[model samples]
Target chain A: MTPRLFQRTASAVLVVLITVSVLFPLAWMAIAGFKGRNEVLRSPFQFFPDMWRFDNYVDIARDPEFTRAMGVTFAGALIFTALSLVVNSLAAYAFARLEFRGKRFWWVYCVMPMFIPMMAILLTSFMVVTKLGMLNTMAVLIIPGVASGAQMFFIRQFYLGFPVAVEEAAMIDGASRWQIFLKLFLPQSAAPFVVMGIASYLAFWNAYVWPILTITDPNLTQIMQFLGTFRSARGNDWGMLMAGSTLASLPTILLLLVFQRFIVNGVRISGIK
Target chain B: MALTPTLAPGPQTADAGRSARGRRGRVKTPPHRRDNRTAYLMIAPMVILLGIFVMWPLVYSVYLSTYEINFYRGSTFVGLQFYRYVLESPDFWHSIVVGLYYSALTVPAMIIIALLLASFIKTLSRRAAAFMKTTVYLPTVVSTVVASVLFVLIYQDEGVANWLLSLISFGPVNWLNDPQLALPAIAVPGIWLGFGLTTLILLAALLDIPESYYEQAALDGAGFFARLWYVTLPLLKNVLLYLFVTGFTLAIQMIDLPLIMTNGGPSEATNTPNLYIFNTFRDVTPYATSYSLTASLLLFVVIGAISAVVFRLVRSDKAIDG
Candidate 1:
């Protein structure tokens, strides 16, 4: 074979290998969710289930704690997303457009949290939240993350790229600073807002450690918290675990499918993680 | 018309905005003058939240590390005793070693795999590349805990993994149950769920390379491997460096996988420092809180040092220029 033909064959094989390795686990999870309890742990494992058990999902649906956890997690994520969008974008606008005393100083001060890894402060932040009597409350989940240096920085960069002509045009129309920001700048920033919104929502939804520390009440448990605890308690029940994990991953998966463009952009822009 | 003098472009804003200032003819202040009150109001929420929660806690962690907490009586100032104790503890050192081990397993492997997959994918048809990219990235949206649960099933003795080995005429292996195999077993899922994003990022970098570089190399009779080594890799140096530093730091701090999969078990082979600190916090004792805090700070300092050394070693002024 020619060198080019060999290379093409190798590329094809690698592509198939990469795709299967990447997806086979997820496909297993989805398939296993439909298997009967005995079938999941059956020796010389069967790739396909004898009977597709929809009752696994039915069990999840009948679970009040699971439903409540889903509600609480979704509500908290939405609220957090809204709050971070407002708070971070406001700060981003100020950093991008407004000039003030100690601009450099305060900018550094606001974005300083980026320098400290969250794990380093996790213990003390838990203590602080506990001291404020916010443990087991949704406020603990939402409040601490509302002010994000990374989001502020990202939005600031986006805003800086905006043409200055629009703002000047708005100013000539006798708009106040508030009017220009509220009416002009904010609307024009829909793309970054969508990016930040999806990012914040996903962060809140996918959070594990902090939720475990702060929320012990089953009703207040986040989805990941619920899944983690459930996985341990029901260690032998592979069917239930797969069902719950599928349910847990559904929203984010759906979001990715629907908002592929924005999510990919967000990942590209915030590539550190 | 630039009624808001703050809209001017530079430190020397008066001259730049003079055209608009003259058009508006309503300038009553210096061109560089800013609306301090508006800026202050705009930034108030972030400043206040970050101060009370983020900044204050960082400082307070240092303070908490110095003092020992006693729930029965009260807290007392120990003045770095906890720090010294934690630093000297063999378990603390073991946890650090485990963290380093995990990073060693993850960082380079992920980078190389990602690099190869990305460069290969770059040669595909655009449609095929898009399909590959989407499939690879699909798992990234799954929460870490959920992925761990899926892997827990996959790594079971009677699970798909062992069944696959059976296909190759190998015996079933205890993946998470064996001390020797557990850490590496756990790293499999970490790489599985992780490298997709890295591949996507690297693929983007690969696509950005100018065709002329490859053409230039081919004109000099460079083979595929030579062209890749000389042209492609050098152009991707900054991005690779950035990914390496960030990926290594993140890997060393891994908690979700170990915490869920092994709980740092099989003779504590997978107990990352973050896991050790977490376990200490959960199983509280008189000085557990302070010990955990000190350990956390130490780990942070080590991570800082590692990042700094890598950045220093790769001290290209263009390290993050893209």
Candidate 2:
């Protein structure tokens, strides 16, 4: 083969290899979820289960704790994301549109949380959460995270990216700044709101440490956290574990399938680039 | 024109509206700075929330770091002693080495893999490029715990590797359990998770590379490596440095995988500082996990050093530019 053909072929193979490396483990996970305990341990050729075990799904679902964890995750994700949208966007809007005293300071403090590594802050935040006697509740979990840097930054980016003509028109109409913000600016920021909203949903959905940190109540844990219980359990059942993991991953997978375009656009805007 | 009356600029006329309020039962509205007040009110929720949750807690962490006290219980103050202890701890030193080791493994591997993928993907049609990019990034959105759990099942003893190994007449390598291999095993999943984002970044960057550079190199009959070294690498130096800092920062805080898969297991071999802090706080208590003051203090210094290092790298780069 010519050198060019060889290079193209080599590149094609590498691309396929990278894709397989990323996706294969996930495929293995799906395969394992259906595998029997014996099959899970079999030779490589028999890696796919001879018989699919449907019982693990029923067993995991039958557990009341898992169901409750679902409730917690939904509540936590919804309330926290909403609260963050309201709170951080307000500040974000203010910074983007308002001529406030100490605007720079407000902007700094608003986005400062992004820098305080969770490792550095979680230790003290836990203490505060403990001292406040708000443990074992999703309320605290949702509330603390409601003022996040990522959300504020994204919302502010949206606000900054918005056109000034609308604000000027609002002023001409004698609309108050708040009126302009609520009625004018917000309506135009749907793109970023969607982005921030999905990011918040996924973040809250994926969060583990905070719930495990703040809430010890077995009942209040999110689905992800409940799934994590398998990790610490003695003699991990690979089949049952993968089944739980597969189920836990389903919503997110479904999310991607549905909103992949929105997610990509959102990720681009949200600095995941 | 009517709004100018609201200004009431002259001192003599400032009280005129107040005195005239009796004559007009419907009092003229006080000069309304509605815009400023509304802006302030709009931002108040975020300000209060951030102050209490992020800013205050971070300050309190820094404050707590300076003292000598037990977090779970109560204690007296001894300023800077905790920093000294944290500086002195063998575990803390080990953590630094381990963090650097993980970053050392991840950043270089990720860059190379990302570059390879970007170059490969660039050769694809636009529609195909988009699909491939999406597929690669799809894993990033999955919760880390879920990903970690998935990998754990694959890495299990008598699991996929062993099954595959028997076909090749090779022994099942203890992928995760062995102390010597545990960190690398964990690091592999991390690199997998990381490579897509980096690939996308580099690809986006590569698309912007002036065609002239490649044209010039092609005319010279330069090999791919030569083009990469002579053209791509120098142009991408700043972005590469930025990724180095950002990727290193995130990798240093490796928590979810260790938490979900190993919990720093087999002998704390994968015990990252986050997990260690987690263990200290919740080693016993469910909610009041960070009760150990010393543990909290130690983590502060450790993370602070990391932050300083990352910041210093950026600053030095800026200095060099200046």
By DockQ, the best candidate is: 1
In candidate 1, position B158 carries an lDDT of 92
Please write out the lDDT profile of model 2 over residues A181-267, one tens digit for every residue.
Answer: 788877777777666766677778888777776777877877777777765653667677777777777776777667666654554
Q: Encode model 2's per-residue lDDT on B1-322: one tens digit a residue.
A: 0000100111112223443453254233244522457667877887777677667777787776555455455755667666566668777666666767777888889888888878878888777677788778777767788878777766766666666776788878898889888888888788887877677767766776788889899899999899999888776665566566667767877788888778877777887876776776655542233234455555555656775776676556532120
DockQ of each: 0.49, 0.41
**Candidate 1 residues A42-68, lDDT tens each?**
897898899888988899877888889
Candidate 1 structure lDDT: 0.81
DockQ of 2: 0.41
User: Can you give the TM-score per candidate against the true fold?
Assistant: 0.91, 0.85
Q: Candidate 2: lDDT of B103?
A: 78
Q: After superposing candidate 2 on the true structure, give the runs of residues whose Cα lies further than 4 Å from its correct spot.
A: A1-15, A231-235, A267-273, B1-35, B66-74, B165-168, B283-322
Which candidate gets the maximum TM-score versus the true structure? Answer: 1
Model 2 lDDT at residue B28: 36
